[model samples]
Each structure stands twice: as C-alpha cells, then as structure tokens.
Target: MKLLKGLWIGFWSGLILGLLLKWIQSVTGEQVYTLLLNVDFVPVIGSVQWSEITEFIFHMIIALVIGVVFVYVAKRRNYSFGQLVLISLLMSAPFPFLYFLLSWLAVEAEVPAATDWSAFLYWIFAHLTYALLLPILYKTFERKNAVSQ
Candidate 1:
C-alpha cells in the first residue's frame, strides 16, 4: 500500500512538474536545460537529450525515489498524512540545489559553466506544485482507504 501510494504520487507529480516546467520555459523564452557540452569544457559526463518521452521516464524515476523516501521518513516520524506531505515537500527543497550543483559538476567539473537561474525557478515552482497537490491527493486517497476499511 505504501509503495503504491509512493508510485502514484511520483507519477502524477512528475508529470505535472515536467509539464509546468516546459510551459514556463515556453512562456518565459528561457531554456530550462542546457547541453553541457555546448557550455565550455563540460565533457558530457552524462546527458539526457531533451525528449518528452525520455524526460517523462527520468521524472518518474526520480519522483518515485523521492516519494518512497518521503513516505518512509514520514512513517518513521509517525506523522499524519497531511503532515507527511508537508514534511516531504520541505525535504525535497534541497533536491533542486543538489541537482544543479551535480549537473554543473558533471558537465564541467566546475561551477558557473551552467548557472541557469531559470532552472532553479522552474524546479521551485514544480516542487511547490507537487507539495500543494500532495495533501489533496492524500486526502482523496485516504477517503478511499476509509471506505475500503
């Protein structure tokens, strides 16, 4: 049940985040991601070319891990569903920063090679959206659980 919950949250949240980010990029005329190779001496440590399908897969995987970890941590803390959602969102706050740093390092083993504030803003909005929706989803699902019980 917990695992299922995690996967559900992950899939939906990831899709929402991805779409929102893309939309924001389109509207702002800013690119959310940059090919590190194009930046400088940023050898492609790893690259996921911006394909919708590939992006979906990657988002799903990352969100799944995040959701699982969030639920596990929340359970350990004995938090209510609402509380868990909030905590999980807060916990995920650092993910964007970490991702940015790792991305920059992976590309060029240095900072400032790819310092896109838009990416950070995109991540913030996406994460916040996930956080906001999570509690609502939890409540909806919890009602279902109650009915089943």
Candidate 2:
C-alpha cells in the first residue's frame, strides 16, 4: 500500500515537474536548460531520436526510486512537511546539479552563456519546485489515505 502510494506520487510528481520545466523553457524562448535537449546523443546511439521520451522516462524512474525511499523512510521517522521538503530537495538536486556541472564543463556543449547565472538559478528553482510539489502531493494523498482509513 505504501509502496503503491509512493510510486503514484513519484511518477506524477516527476512527470509534472519535467513537463513544467519544458514548458517554462518554451515559453521564455530560452535556450534549452536540460543538457539532453541539446546533446547530440544520436550519432552515438545511431538513429534514435527518442531523446525526449527517454529523458522523461529516466527522470520518472529516478523520481520513483526517490519516492519509494522516502515512503519507507517516512514510515520510520515521521518527518514534518518542511523536513520532507528539505529532504526532497536534497535528494533531487544532486542529479541535476551534476548535469549542470557537466554542461558547464563540456566545451562542445551548446549551453547558453546566460546559463552561467540565470539558467543555473532556474535549474535550482526547478529542483526546489519539484521538492515543494512532492510533499504537497504526499499531504494531499495522505489526507485521502487517512479518510479512507
């Protein structure tokens, strides 16, 4: 039961977050913030233009793993909403941050010059946004879980 709830929350939260980030970039007319969007991974893989779909699924899987872990941990510790949010950010930020580092390092990467500051901030904001949403999702479903009990 708990595992199912975790998967539900994680999958949706990650999908929503990924979609939201993509939408923001589109709306802002900004250069791609996500490295995968700009990477020439095709020649390496040969004929696979499924980059967008693959990235989403990869991130969703990551979120699912985090969600499952969070639920199991919460079962023992019972963190408050704020603590959970912090934990979520802590768990979520590193993966993207590492990407940001790689993007910064990759000389051949078509990264935005503004990414040095602005896009990096948005990257942080995006992760923080994900963290904020996950707990809210948890609390919402938690209410449902409680009432059903």
Candidate 3:
C-alpha cells in the first residue's frame, strides 16, 4: 500500500515536472527538456534513438523509485508534516547537480551546457515545484485512502 501510494504521488509529480520542463524548453529554447529525456550517456542504450515517450517513461521509472523510497521511509519514520516538507525539499535540492553530472557525462547527447545559468535556474524552479507538490500529493493520497478505509 505504501509502495502504491508513493507510486501514485511520483506519477503525478513526475508528469507535472516533465510538462513544466518541456514547456520551459519550448518557451526559452533551452535544452532542459532534451536533458530530461536524454539517455545518450548510457553505454548500451546510447546506440539506439528512443522516442520521446519512451525516454519519458525512463524518467518516470526513476521517479517511481524515488517515490517508493520516499513513502516507505516516511511511513516507517512516521514523520511530521514539517519533516516531510523538509525531506521533500532536501531530496529534491540535489537535482540541479544532476544536470551538470549529465552534461559532463554526455557523449554525443545534446544536453544543456554545464554552465547554462538560465537553464540551471529553470531546472531548479521545476524541481522546486516537484518538491512542493510531493507532500500535497502524498497527503491527498493518504486522505483518499483513509476515506476508502
């Protein structure tokens, strides 16, 4: 149940985050969206060109893992609201660094440059939005479950 709850939150949050990043890229002409779906760094998988939906599914799979871990930990720890909020923020805070890591690791992938400040800031905003939505989604799921129970 906890796992499912986490998956639910993760699915919605990831979808929203992906859309936000895609929109940002479209409007700003940044490569953030491309970065999000890029897998050119992966050795075996790098050889094949993936459709955007397939790449987005890869992203969602990661999101689902993150969600499951977060909810499992939260359930076990029984954290307070403030603590959950903090956890969400702390968990998401390092995401921007992932951009740099990907940029550094990318071979022929067209990702954002390591020093694109605007894209970095946009990435930060999109992640922060995800962080903010996590608790809300978790609580909503909890409430719905409670009512069902």
Give each model's whole-structure lDDT: 0.60, 0.68, 0.88
- How far residue 36's Cα lies from its native spot in candidate 2, in Å, is 5.7
Clashes of each: 0, 0, 0
Query: Model 2 over residues 1-149: C-alpha lDDT tens digits?
Result: 88998898888788777877787677764444465344344356324455678756766887898777777766667789888787777777675665556566544546555346666665667667777877888878888989999
Instruction: Choose 1 or 3, whichever is better by lDDT.
Output: 3
Order by lDDT, highest first = 3, 2, 1
The lDDT leader among the candidates is: 3
Model 1, span 1-149: residue lDDT tens: 88888777667766776677667666765544332112333345134344556545655687777766655665465567778666867876775675465555554323322366755666567668877666556556667888999
TM-score to true structure, per model: 0.69, 0.77, 0.94
Q: Which stretches of candidate 1 lie over 4 Å from their true place?
A: 33-51, 76-78, 106-119
Models sorted by TM-score, best on top: 3, 2, 1
* Candidate 3 Cα errors over 4 Å, as ranges: none
Give RMSD to native, each candidate.
4.8, 3.3, 1.2
